[model samples]
Target: MNLRKVGSKTNVLMMLFCILFLTSACGSTVSNNATAETAVATSSSEEKTETVKKTEPVKVVWWHSMSGGLGEAVDKLVADFNSSQENVQVEAVFQGTYDESLNKLKAAMDSDSSPALMQVYEIGSRFMIDTDAVTPVQTFIDQEKYDISSLEANILGYYTFDNQLYSMPFNTSNPILYYNKDAFKAAGLDPENPPKTYEELAVAAKALTSEGQTGASFAIYGWFIEQLLANQGVEFINNGNGRTTPATSSLLNSEASVATLTWWKQMLDDKSMMNLGRKTDDTKKAFAAGQIAMTLDSTASLRGIVSSADGKFEVGTGFLPKPEGSSDGGVVVGGASLWIMNNKSQEEQQGAWEFIKFLAEPATQAYWHVNTGYFPITQKAYDEQIVKDNLTAYPQFQTAIDQLHQTKLNLATQGAVMGVFPEARQLTETAIEEVLNDSKSPQEALDDAAKAISSKIEEYNLTVK
Candidate 1:
């Protein structure tokens, strides 16, 4: 109160002091606010960096042989897996047909540039195992303590050796008889019941054959021959189909095989069966176009055949016809399995395993089975709604399921596990062609093929040993 009465100079000094004090207080408040803001920004930046690190995905290359609908389904599965987690991304590359893919893989191995994962056919399994270029699926299972109890026993049995799973079974299929229901009905044959024996099939073919249509057609592939041999309880190679030990010889000229080839030759001679040569799609087309009454192909072909038919004619399926009077035999599983390349980094291997595990889940398997006509590798997949709906829509698929369930697991049914199986199959195919073209008798052609396979097996066994 007495400041007013003070001198003008004193008043000015007091006013200056008040202004300086307020300015200093405001500066301190601003500095504290700036420091707090900087701390918050730094914390937010650190959090974002951590998030980026956690979301970084491990990329894996998967070389496969699937094509057509199966290829599309695989791409979908990979996309789903990529979206499911930020930990891994799979690149699915189509490497041509199964045989071509295997050849390419061998070439890649030679260059030491193989993919992180590969899909190898059943025939290529022994060779893949022998090369030691891949890690067993069981290794990862053991490391993760994964429960594989949901896997289908029959499908799993095909890939197991020495009580260990070498590869993850995917897109598994078995051979079955696909026929035109309208053609059967037109020929006065029972469409509801298809042939179950080779002799009966011949009878039906004779009835179904006409001026423009053949009763049956089949690709001159070794797979059906192998299936026939298995159905007759004939092992393709010695040493329990190469399961007990490495095979040194082939049983291509066994009595059962000779009889099967003879029957096939007789069918061709009678003009009841059309030989489509080695191209599988040719036979499939012929059957789908109603030019042939029936064809024998893998269950995997069901989707393609049905799509190709496209309401032109109803399709029917049955178990592959057994040899007359044969017993205690069954069809072997076909299709490919997934293998993890051994030489990749640990992260890549683990990533590949994770992708494979995702594929084996019930939901993925169900989706795959419904989309592509391959049987699911896991039994639980059948319980999924998609699979149930598909089965209801296409009951023909049930024939394959029933056939698989009816199959007796044994050495013959498990198929030949020879390292030279590819060569053996080639020789067998050659033998069939020889007989079909009248170049040689069934026994003569088979005997020659057997001799050649024996040599090949001996060579392969010696080298591997």
Candidate 2:
């Protein structure tokens, strides 16, 4: 093709058009790239800020049921824990008694403010598992490959289900007979040799009952009945004391229960053991005041009882009495345990786990054991100096530890579990009253109580399923 020669002005104009076209395209591309880079920078900055916001110590709320002297010990533990670490801070709130604390937990289940750590009574184990509200302690144990061998095996057995440890044992105790040693001596009974059988106990009670003092006064509490039954090596409910499966009925109306109730009735009929209603506090006070020679209470109550009886009489501790010819049985651990709630942040849950492990440590448990009458959850705690000093100073507490070690681990000794344990306790209490008041015979009362509890268990199973 033939081309025409252009003038300089025309060439300059064409060149200018080309330059303008290139400039616009390059500017648009640069603007888009800059926008993308700016967005990336902004996103990165936001992420860094979010991380910084989470750097503060994880604060965990713990709800407990300890009160009075026990409450003081709990406060000290929380204080020590807070001071010992900076990564986690714990605040313990004493909600109330075990029942009250459990009720509050149920009410707060749907709220975001639920407690990260909860102290629940042993009976509440089934309810807690059914709630799906807990991050099993097994999760943390597996994640860390923790050595739980040091923990008391009997205690571990109760909280373990389906090969999973649901919670950590905090304060473990069992029922023991707290008696006035002076009364024993006065009654011509050997102060050193406490009653080991129900017949001996009945005899001692009869001898101790004279003048202003009664021989014994057991609180019409159902827990004692449960313990007595377990002491005689009987299952409180079916399905291996509710360990193998959710129990559908109560075995309360058995020969063991009937005999025990009859004994209590006989004691009342003979005017030896007095009924002080359903509250344990009444019996505890009566024992402390020297109005009653003996009373059945938790080992956890030893410190309080000793202090209460100070300068009045010598407080003596003895193993729980069982029926004659019953060679096998042990008192079940009857204290509360610590549970980590699953509805909390992962960081909070880890913090709770740390607190739990700290409580299970030798020194901490030793301090707990000496200050309160609860047994240490770990056997290593016995190596601590405080525990030794405790045994040396207050030999009464040794009875509980001895009783624990001597106990043969069996289904009956491991204790019972039920979703409606608290209700069952009430029903049993009512039965005790009926028998004591002669309104119903022991067999009739126990049968009625068992039937009622079985109905409740069935209802509970239905809902949980």
User: lDDT scores for all predictions?
Assistant: 0.88, 0.91
- Tens digit of per-residue lDDT, candidate 2, span 1-465: 011333587865664565477677765754665677778889999999999777888899999999988899999999999999888999999999999999999999979878999999999999999999999999999999999988888778778888899999898998999999999999999998989989999999999999999999999999999999888889999999998888999999999999999998999999998989888999999998889998999998888899898998999989999998996888899889999999999999999999998898999999998888889999999999988988887889889988888788888888899999999999999999999998999999999999999999999999998
State model 2's lDDT: 0.91
Compared with the true structure, what per-residue lDDT tens digits does model 1 show for residues 1-465? 234534698765765565567677765754665687778889999999998887768889999988877788889999999999888899999999988988888888856567899999898899999999889999999997999987988888889999999999988998999999988999999999999999999999999999899999878898888999888778888999989987788888998888888888888889999988998988998988888999999998787887788779899999999887897788899888999998888999999999999999999999999888889998898989999999888889999999998888899998889887888888889999999999999999999999999998888878888
Report residue 219 deviation for candidate 1 (angstroms): 1.7
- Which residue segments of model 1 deviate by more than 4 Å? 1-48, 51-56, 110-112
Going through the candidates in the order shown, the clash numbers are 0, 0
As a TM-score, model 2 comes out at 0.87
Give candidate 1's error at residue 275 in angstroms. 2.2
Candidate 1, pairs of clashing residues: none
State the local distance difference test value for candidate 1: 0.88
